[model samples]
Target: MATWPNAAIATLMETCGEAVSNAAWNAILNIVFPCPTYLVAPEQRLDSSRPDLTVYIVGENGVFFPFEGKPAKFSWEKLGGEVLGYCIAARPDAFQGYNYGMGGNGPECIICEYDGANMRYLYIHEGELCQSDKMHVLHIFRDAAEILNVLEFVRGAHV
Candidate 1:
């Protein structure tokens, strides 16, 4: 794992882009994950077409949550494919828990399981079914104390 001592919001903007959504993710992550975070930009080109980001904590815990920060409409079938892409590109090996799910080729969303983490892509559907696609990232906590610590961090940040 690469060490990022200068894991600041400015560094993330330099590496990622100047977008509110990216910034939101960074802020949220900085609050959620106590570990210093950094944005992993794609090589050679500089554009926000694809977002590559990863957060690292001490020891053998890391998570790659690459997201296409945009808004779009999708049907259940299209959403399933997109969710598959997100989960497949997540690189679960970086996290402690690693599991994923596929909706058995059904018209629903393809479920992805990471370790003990589970999320439904159909969360962004509509009305009673509308839900945001599962956000991919590491939410690591060794114990209740750590969870409280994270909560405090978020509360302090007011994110």
Candidate 2:
């Protein structure tokens, strides 16, 4: 896959243009990810529950990432469990088999939590939902360059 880290972020920022709602973020992602390379589906059902956004690889049945967006004021602790549940329900095989430091063989799925300005990356490790301190929290405005890395990782291209 081609890597255009800055390009994706730039498109997202341009599309949203400071808008912070879940719908706005979803729209930005849809514009950023088009079709063939990725399919961005909103309010997709993962088992009996639905996540705010579900990204899938082109022609693939499994999910690449499950995303949940909220306002900037929402508490991470309260929303963390819900995002984790969606990841588990959406891709049980990847979540259950994920192991820390296993390179490309590690978990391929991610649960993305973003609030207008900030974004959080969550993954399943050793039967528990965890976030690395380094990438636990990312700011959209300040960390524009790094956003591409997050997108690539979630797309299973950086694993």
- TM-score, predicted candidate 2 vs. hidden true structure: 0.58
Best by lDDT: 2
Clashes by residue pair, model 2? none
- What's the TM-score of every candidate structure? 0.35, 0.58
Stretches of candidate 1 above 4 Å error?
Answer: 1-18, 37-52, 58-62, 71-83, 94-119, 122-159
lDDT of 2 by residue, 60-121 (tens): 57665666665554555655656656645654343234411100001012235432233356
- In model 1, the Cα lDDT at residue 128 comes to 32
- Model 2 spans with C-alpha error above 4 angstroms: 1-19, 27-34, 93-96, 99-135, 157-159
**How well is each residue in 1-159 modelled by candidate 1, as lDDT tens digits?**
322122343233334433532444444445445554443332112132233233433354333443333221224455445445555554455444442322211111122333333453322122232223453221111122332342343223221
Model 1 Cα shift for residue 104 (angstroms): 25
Q: Model 1: which ten-residue window has the lowest total lDDT?
A: 101-110
